[model samples]
Target: MPPRPRTSRRTRRSARAYAILLPAVAATVALAGCASTVSLEHAEDAAAVECADVVVRLPDVVAEQAERQTDAQGTGAWGDPAAVLLRCGVPTPGPTEDRCVTVDGVDWVIDESDAPRYRFTTYGRTPAVEVVVDNEIVSGTTAITDLANAVSVIPADGACTTVTDPADVTP
Candidate 1:
């Protein structure tokens, strides 16, 4: 009798399982690729109630940061956090800058990028707010990471969530 080839039961079982699952894995990947959501071309047709469109009231962090900035700049009074966030910082690249305001008790991040993901912490409430600048801010952002730790100016009330968009928007 000819010698039989050596084979393991576990190996046969593994091969059978892989053959059965290969098609399923491939189909799942293909479906995921096709299920992506695309943004609308015209801004007018888009939803008017975007996070950027609405500038909710800034909490303690943003308020205090604004006050500190005002005081640092030798200004008498600190204006509104939203306005100050948009107009306060010196003009720079990316146009997707960040504006934070802290009024001693409360503070919130004011990312000028897409969704404007900001965070606030106060005695009564501690919630995060992502403030996007309607059409101005695209789907991405333009700010450096670790801004809170990198820049001492960021108050303790605030914390960095995500990295800022690159300085340049590449095609």
Candidate 2:
């Protein structure tokens, strides 16, 4: 019988490398496709120049949640199930009874009516930015703080002031 040719050690190593690497590459591609696209609506001023700036400046992660792809412009999302969502260009909110908190130098009007799911809208910034956070998965404070730099690009025209402040009172 004719002798079979022996494979070289270098060839064997290359084959083994591919054997281990092929599956890893395939799994990564599969998992990436498995991530569903987040659906969102653009705000009234979504096309504003300031909104584009905010969207471009958004961080890759917020509150430990990795950012996700969104279906709309001037919008951002994070987490597998979307623990935090941001929309730039929402109508700038006016004085309200809702609780307001400042993170960094930016002020946010917090709506806690929904409890664990809270809506935070940037106050006093033109072409306002709005962020909705699922407090159960990530702290709203952390998410808002992470976003402060991006939202700050809009520039503040106003701020959250107490009704008791005499100078802030408007007739």
Candidate 3:
């Protein structure tokens, strides 16, 4: 009887490569099925009715990033890599030099110190909402606009002012 032919060296190497790659591919596929996980710090002041409303009203998609699963309440995140993250009930900020922009009706104080990653906080609302957006992944305005609808639920008590009013200045 003729002896069975031995597998070629190239064939053996190919098989080994495939064996090593198969698990990696499977792991990637499995992770793709699961939503991106976002770790968040829970806010102590987030128990307000307005915060709950904002959370419920948060958009499912922002700047084309689908909302992902977050581990904390009063928090919302978007994008597979979490390009945008929002947290409600943060302590209100006092006077600052940060640039402020109003969208829809909500006032946002923009902090670009980190560049590419921008942090926007509600100006005068109690338990102010804070949104951190990756400008590299999504435009800051777009993220703020998408979240504004939800954040507007919290009424603004005041707004950022660059100049102090003469009437308010004490002699």
| Residue range 13-82, candidate 3, lDDT tens digits | 9999999999999998898677657999978777788899999999999998999988898999999799
The Cα error of candidate 3 at residue 159, in Å, is 1.5
TM-score, every prediction? 0.25, 0.78, 0.75
lDDT (C-alpha, whole model) for all candidates: 0.31, 0.93, 0.91
Total residue pair clashes for candidate 2: 0
Q: Which stretches in model 1 have alpha-carbon errors above 4 Å?
A: 1-4, 37-124, 129-171
1-171: candidate 2 lDDT, tens digit per residue? 999999999999999999999999999999989889999998999999999999899999999999898999899999989999999989889989788888999999999988899999999998888899999999999999999999988888898986576677788
Positional deviation of residue 61's Cα in model 3 after best superposition, in angstroms: 0.7
User: Predictions ranked by lDDT, top down?
Assistant: 2, 3, 1
lDDT for each residue of candidate 1 in 1-171, tens digit (9 for 90 to 100):
999998899989999999999999999888756533322122221222321222222232422323212212111112232222222122112222345444333333444333343321111122222222232222212211211221223223433334556776576
Cα miss at 65, model 1 (Å)? 39
- The most accurate candidate by lDDT is 2
